[model samples]
Target chain A: MGRVVSAASAIRLDDVTLGYDRHPAVHHLTGEIAPGALLAVVGPNGAGKSTLLKGLVGTLKPLGGRIDRGALKVREIAYLPQAAALDRSFPIDVFDLVSTGLWRRRGLFGGLSKGDRATVAEAIASVGLSGFERRQIGTLSGGQLQRALFARLALQDAAVILLDEPFAAIDAKTVSDLLELVARWRAETRTVVAVLHDLETVRRAFPETLLLARRQVAWGPTSEALRPERLLEARGMQEAFDDHAPVCAVDHAA
Target chain B: MTPYDALVAPFVEFDFMRRALVGSLALSVGSAPIGVFLMLRRMSLAGDAMAHAILPGAAVGFLVAGLSLPAMTIGGLAAGVAVAVLAGLLTRTSVLKEDAALAAFYLLSLALGVTLVSLKGSNVDLLNVLFGSVLALDDDALFLLAGVSSLTLLTLAALYRSLVLECVDPGFLASVSRSGGPTHFVFLGLVVLNLVAGFQALGTLLSVGIMMLPAASAAFWSARLSGMFVAAIAVGALASLFGLLGSYHTGVPSGPAIVLAAGALYLVSIAFGASAGLVWRLLPARRHRAA
Candidate 1:
């Protein structure tokens, strides 16, 4: 019942280097995310999975090489930061919170039309939060809040959707429900990239995977990228990395 | 005393009392909602800091213009915005957090302001700047209060949606639109403007009282932002009315009386309000039927 328009485009990363304080966190990454691609980014803790998503969402600028979005504006990309970044105690309800997704459509001053209200309701129902419309978001459990966030993202109607640990700490039922929504996005030819920890969920739901440990460990089909040896290599690489290392040389665009 | 003799007669007989009531009512409409937003943003004390930050500027204005409304207001606005911007810059560039930076600047500002006020003016003038002369509000001051109230309401209406998004999920708003940072700065400007508006009737020290007391009290009664806004304005207006009357009858300072009235409401709300009030905690939980 929800028909939100999303223009499709491929995202190209040419030796992208993302970092803080000139220190590379996710360095020397190069790849193209084709339109309608459903990809999972897997890594150990501090392996720069979240950093990569930040780079894609344009919150963090690449310290070295460029990320080419072709023609997509940063506003047209939907990003769900980790739950820790959210302030749940702010006084707002489920329906109002979800309607914030229409920011790009309605903008800073435009009022939501009748059709827009119906679309918001549909998005809420799709997330199984039909009756919780008037409930304050602070009262929502983590899973329910995540579902509400997904509903908000659905209304964003963006070409590229990036999520940082979207299913972390979620129940299996909630994870399954959210995954179905992700699949529906893929069916609509929207690009979906998620930072994930659970290998089992990745193997089941994602066809393509980028296994990373501050650098690309493997990038291919999920089965090949998540092989046992590659995972071990990722872990070893993460452990051997020095936290106090000096800034690395900047990459010259090839 | 009869109801008319006690409540109605003070305002009817004394022109100054009527002016005081109208001035504070304007403050209630303009400043209280800003206070609600401040409370929601978890920046309640930040409002207090900003109020103090305006002191040195207003003091300078007083020194130069001898209590001219325009001079003191411009000075107060400049000082408040300068401190806000400086503190914001420090938070961005250094390890100092926004609160710590603001505290440091405002403490110095309060010292400078008081020193400036005491330089040329008498103790009475110092008391006027510190606690306000609400009963002596001139036409210029009244006009300033009304203008600021009208402007604050209009600006808030235009910025409502973005302000909500900025408060609840700043990062999300930053992702989708460029309004997040600009909206926040504008909200801070509104806070300073309201405080400036209130300073004439309530003074720099006590002005924030009218803003914060009612807003914080409203939190006890409601969870919805709209409800909180209504409750806060109601509480503020009631406090202004009673405080002015009480001041006329009791021979106490009017500014503190008004603020104290608001404080009393806040305390009462804490005990008996509808949402998470102390009384609710003391009562037995209501049973919910299983579906």
Candidate 2:
């Protein structure tokens, strides 16, 4: 078994192609994300943004190539999937739900210690949901549920964190608050990659950007990646791509 | 009649009544919480499907051993698990979704079971296998019921967190740990085991009724998983007790009596339960001062 690495580790994508059943959703992507890097993945709808996040987190294995997490074990990477994938109607309160973040550390059978309880409470408080600790997750508003999810991420204490559309459809106030939490992760020297939609927010807060549209359009500083022509090219590529295209010849040979 | 004469005297007077009560209460202890999870996972009908899926296996065992306990138990368990695994595989490998695949297989299994049971046995034997004879529980049947109940409780405790995580956010659980798939199968195994336990008392047809009705009623009373577990078990126990008494007094079959008792509670909970009963929904909302 690999020793769990809590310290930050660089994730290297080596000509990675990820897709479903030989149809490439995101392909031929090569990039190295540095430890402590705050990277935003910006792409249009159906541009495989969420797929990229899945690939990074090891949930979706690559169809070709490999994602090399230098020293990070599986548990050392915390992933927050889209809220749509979550079952909000489940009978769980915010505090218990957030405590699930301690899973990697405490594991299946371990009881939560007093300090762990304090940490859970603190995580909830940090998310501005202190008063709603006992509220059932089903009762929470979308923004509040996002906050609770962010709180769970805080408790994960992983070397790397991945968020899929953490702010989509969320209110402005909650977005800023969660962005602050992201900044805190960066300050703590953890790798943070978020799938983002708002170009303005990405340029403002994200130091690095990977602009993708079924393929890498730009991978560099946010300013360079978000350039107008590159953005237009990404949009065009997405619209023009054929879903029924045969397996990639390049991926086949490699 | 006095409450004691009506409720307490049946168990005190008849050995069969006591045995039936003990058998069913034990079955409920194991099965009701499993039903709660099945309900939470929105696989309530899947439980019914699995109950039917076990029938052909039990029928085969009956054919080979003439209603022997171990043979039928093992056969039913094997059949239930096979169906669950096959349905899961079909969902992954084919276009059909999980529920549709399950329904398809269970219907086939049900038809096969009835045909097989009718091959050698009379209609009485067939009805016995279908509706169960709770009042005629032998020592072996009682022991099986207790054993399955104890195992279910222990397994539920051991796997509670993992099972909860699997139910609520399977993707997240998969991302975080490797226990998701195994946990799911274990849960399905427990479901089958409980259904088999239930088969002895409520039989294949009404076994799911004991599991689902209490769980559905519990949903009305509790908003937390732990609370629902308690409520479900309580309802299950009460239904078994009342159903047995009702059977004793009314001459109805004990199996249907137990299930009907659970169904009655479910209906009552729908109207008056604390969580989201119809009365609460219909009542005018209280005006709240601005916080």
lDDT of 1 by residue, B12-37 (tens): 89898889999999989998899999
Give all TM-scores, in the order shown: 0.96, 0.95
DockQ (CA atoms), all models: 0.78, 0.70
Expressed as tens digits, the lDDT of each residue in B1-291 for candidate 2 is 999999899899999999999999999999999999999999999999999999999999999998788888888998999999899888868999999999999999999988999998888888888988899999999999999999999999999999988887887787778887778788889999999989889988899998999999999998888889999999999999999999999999999999999999999999998887889988899898897
Q: For residue A142, give model 1's deviation from the true position in Å.
A: 1.0
Q: Which CAPRI tier for candidate 2?
A: medium
Q: How does residue A86 of candidate 2 score in lDDT?
A: 79
User: What fraction of correct interface contacts does each candidate retain?
Assistant: 0.85, 0.73
Pull out the clashing pairs in model 1: none
State the C-alpha lDDT per candidate. 0.90, 0.90
Error at A186, model 2, angstroms: 0.7
lDDT of 1 by residue, A131-227 (tens): 9999999999999999999999999888889989999899999999999999989888889999999999999999999999988889989999999
